[model samples]
Target: MKRRQIYFILVLIACNFTLGYAQNPFEVIEEPLPYSKKASSFTINIIGYNEDFVINEWQKYITDFSGLTYVTAVNKGVVEMESSGVVFPLLNDNKVNLYTRFAPNKTLTGVLLTVWVQKSDGTFFSSESSKKEAERIKDWLFEFQDKIRLLNTRIKYQQRF
Candidate 1:
């Protein structure tokens, strides 16, 4: 009798689990980005260059290097993105609103960068913030100049292929 009861209990438990799962046939969960958005700006002044080359290399660099590749946006002269890393202590983040500009027919110019802490009437967001990301952004733009130089050499050899 005891053996039969034990077997009965096990079957009941198994049925409970199966039914619970069946009730929710299709359950889906979406995840958020690992890092919080902080704001910063950086520039590289390589004037009189081809627009196509500039945008392409930047897309490759921004999308390829940062862990935020899945969420990063690389549009014409504007990139809205994030980098995954340390969380910041501040309540809110300094959103990295990266935007770019180009001359219609190659106006001569260079690049610049700036960073700041946002004013606090803001709700607490620093908890979700990623540290050193802004610095890394500056570095990304800094590296961009070099990528263009290398690209230029490749283009020279390829003769605009």
Candidate 2:
């Protein structure tokens, strides 16, 4: 390959990597609930760079969230609205985004708990607040688990591997 062509390919790859690292403008950066009890409900919001990208990401986000166990429904909408109900306050009012409402009495906790895909530059972002919320939301989860090493019989029984 020509040197110029090789340089172009390298630049493209770097851009993609950077984009993956950047948060999705249309999506909220969420941390997985610390407890996997199942969420009472959750909303996944994704921002769009344009009409086409908005529709495209909305579709992909739904498809991905649907595979999860506790996602009761995926709410789709544009980012232009003053309030995106669930996603607005959390996403800092990005122009394009998507959100999903989780079911009641459930939790999620683990590595890479919440992954937000931002469109501004196709990057990813996360936060401690999101993790704290996930932990808080666990209280509402039906099958939720307590992190504390309680001595109660039930907790002990459940703790046994």
Ten-residue region with minimum lDDT total, candidate 2: 140-149
> Candidate 2's residue-wise lDDT over 49-115, tens digit each?
2333333433343344332222333434222211121232234533322233322212221111122
What is candidate 2's CA lDDT for residue 100? 32
Candidate lDDT scores, in order, read: 0.43, 0.33
Cand. 1 TM to true fold: 0.37
Query: Best-fitting candidate, measured by TM-score?
Result: 1
RMSD of each: 19.4, 17.5
Candidate 2: segments with Cα more than 4 A from true spot: 20-23, 29-31, 40-161
lDDT of 2: 0.33
Residue-level lDDT tens digits of model 1 in 52-103: 5665555565455332322245455443433332122222333322234332
lDDT of 1: 0.43
Per lDDT, the best of the predicted structures is 1
Residue 19 accuracy (lDDT) in model 1: 88
